[model samples]
Target: MSEAARQAWPTVRSIPVSAVTDAKPPGRLRPARLEQVAGSSGTGRDTTGGGTATGVGTAGAKPSAGSASSAGSASSGTHARANPAAELGFSGDPGQHGDAGDGMLHAQRAWDATLATNRLDNLGVNAERQRLVIKDVTAAVGLLVDGWPADVRACVQSVIDHTDVSVLALDLGNLDGAGDVLDDLAARYPDRVAVWRVAERPHWRGGTATWGESRAKLLRLDESDVHVLMETSIVLRGDGLTPLVAAVAEGAVAAGWRGVDPADGREAGPGRVPALTGDLMAVRRSAALSALPEDANYGRNADLELSLGLRGELVVPQGALPVERLGTHDVQADYRERESQRNYDGVLRMLSAS
Candidate 1:
């Protein structure tokens, strides 16, 4: 050897093997982390030899459940805080690969999300969903005598038979003996039905009980979780009230049997409707009370306006309701057309301005 090369090499001193083998890894992880890193890198089997650091330090030692969980959590945290691509074995800058790198990253994230969801399912996390029980729904119907007394009786009777909700009726001038029928219903089902009779008649029939004012009065009288705006013409063929109530409890401001979505950006039908029809509208009592429009003379498009003004979703479960109509089919065509046009005009104007 050259004199300079000999001078550069230091004299060898023997160190005890116990000094290296006895050393412990920092924190509670012990030396299992080294084995984990080696396992992920595909070199753990080779490192299992007695001469390797892991084998010497942690021979025949297995990680406990708690330590394994903690180590897995720590590894996940590291992966999140550091470049994910590097953790996944990608070399150099991940941004340089552009689309390919983005695709892989997305795939990885998707897999992680799926795994988490599956884990939650296995643990029965979703098996205990909280049940929604909305009690004491109030059904309100306005009587104008435009339909027959039998129709009114059938409508009220269906409500009492199909559901246990309380019934409240406003008898407007008792046209065609409809008021007397409502009084009889209230007397027959005294505990479940309440009636308020008025001398003023409906505006459509040429009396004084306007649609908006009468509906607002019904709203004021309701003392329940949900208030049903039912028409004297709508008769339930099955338990239609439960679905509407469930929808309200599920977060909708109002739920109805018939609904329309706004059509071509206009507050009109034959297109998407932003409003539910008032035929058998069920609304959260407080929300309906807050948005009630008292001056509306005809109930036509007034319901649509109220729905659009609500703060929550409008849901109409049409198929869920086994409902049949009993009145308005025999009404004068000209009067219905005029009232509908008036309401649609208001809706159009509101849409145009907004």
Candidate 2:
């Protein structure tokens, strides 16, 4: 070959033999010979001209100059030619990308295993036990009040005279001389009436404390099967709590007064009412307690929020129980109306989101 021709021909200097071996076609190259070449110390640079060199067939054809360096580094030994996908025995079915089908199959198999481990009959037994447990449960009441000491006293006295369940009266800021009234009621009916005093004034309408914090506080202090949220403004003429508690006892999550909405004068019924009048409502302790929002304020329509959260849960009205509305006091009427609107807005927001 002419010197010029030899110079023009590509030189395999600095290119690893491994690179040469990896560039070989699959199945055409011998793995044993490739391994041997890799282990060999033959580091001499080869210079050639014309078509190709002896012993170095077209297998080690050099790629473009740009990719040659990277290709050379990657193709170090016979192992370089080994297909990672082939070693994994990957099914080339495009559907089997990243073992996704296998993952789904494994998930199905796990579900089947779980189903096999626990028979349907076992589940039935558990459900029956749960129903029996609920049958044995009895409901209790919690009265939330703040003002009109005579009204609170009268209301509590009626509850003592009529209902068999325990009543917890939470006095908020002590209105209508409620502090003294609560004290007298507590002293008179020590077993039935348990009194708690809150120093803060009610932020919501009516003389009652804020529903959110007040309800939460009451739940924390008292352990009752049913929690009756009774407003001191409403006077009970009959065994109001008994029927309410009975409604809750019949798998109902909540029970309250069936009345016309004060704002619209629309008749609201029991079972699935638009909202439970907070003035008088009996809630299953677990259900109502669970429905309360963590950071809910007293100003917004908290009762509506609670109802919305427990949408599918049962709600009934104690039809036989007559609750006489003695009307709300004027002390914070305007602020209460504004706060109620704020709460109603919150309820609308929640409902829209749902």
Leading candidate by lDDT: 1
Give the per-residue lDDT digits (tens) of candidate 2, residues 243-330: 5654455444566775333345366653335456667777656556667763454523667667666533334442245568777655
Worst 10 residues of 2 by lDDT: 35-44
Query: What's the distance in Å from true for residue 3, model 1?
Result: 99
lDDT by residue for model 1 over 4-100, one digit each (tens)?
Answer: 3212111011111122211321121112111111210001222342232221123223443434224444567645545544444455574554345
List residue ranges in candidate 2 displaced over 4 A.
Answer: 1-136, 204-209, 259-265, 293-300
Computed on alpha carbons, the lDDT of every model, listed in order, comes to: 0.57, 0.52
- Give Cα distance to truth, residue 126, candidate 2, Å: 30
Give the clashing residue pairs of candidate 1, or none.
201-209, 260-273, 261-272, 261-273, 262-272, 262-273, 262-274
lDDT of 2 at 318: 21
**lDDT score, candidate 1:** 0.57
Q: Compute each candidate's TM-score over C-alphas.
A: 0.58, 0.56
Indicate the residue-level lDDT of 113 in model 1: 53
